[model samples]
Target: MTSDLDTLFSDAFERANNTTKKFAPDVQLRLYAYYKQATKGDNFSYNNEDNLKNAFKFNAWIQLKGMDENEAKENYIKLVNSILK
Candidate 1:
């Protein structure tokens, strides 16, 4: 991504972080997976946690599977746009 696009994506991401909109569980999981894949490739391992919240987060992150960073970023940007709209 170019610097301008990167800036846009970053701003969108920040907006997403600040949004108070309530998303469905699947939507939230998708957003989390996209953000994780975009920022940190597919090289992360979720430590098994006893907490339900942590478990769900880990599963969400793992669901991204083989998604590429650019694709993830694009999806994340799209999701943010949809939410903001």
Candidate 2:
């Protein structure tokens, strides 16, 4: 069964994916990690492959310090959804 939330996510993903190419390094990093976290659970470990897949997350997070978490989450969701679609 599909939910409205799913559709919303799909739309957001489409937007983000199309927008990803223009994202700056910091934005890309956050989007990458945000996508990983959204698809995966929070407890997911940072194993080698996982870390390799997300070389930018750490840097993005660091750069985004002092930023609002909710904004970050929104942006991440959009960015991730974009990449997946």
Taking all chains together, each candidate's TM-score versus the true structure is 0.82, 0.50
Compared with the true structure, what per-residue lDDT tens digits does model 1 show for residues 1-85?
A: 4776577679888898898887888788888888888888788876665588778877888878798888888888998898788
Alpha-carbon local distance difference test for all models: 0.82, 0.56
Q: Which residues of candidate 2, in runs, are more than 4 Å off?
A: 43-53, 58-85
lDDT of 2 by residue, 4-83 (tens): 55555556666776663576675667766555544443434444565553555654444554545445456666666555
Least accurate 10 contiguous residues by lDDT in model 2:
37-46
Q: Model 2 clash pairs?
A: 13-81, 13-82, 17-82
Q: Kindly report which residue stretches of model 1 are placed more than 4 angstroms away from their true locations once superposed.
A: none
Which pairs of residues clash in candidate 1, taking residues 3 or more apart in a chain or in different chains? Answer: none
Say which candidate scores most in lDDT: 1
Best by TM-score: 1
lDDT of the structure predicted as candidate 2 = 0.56
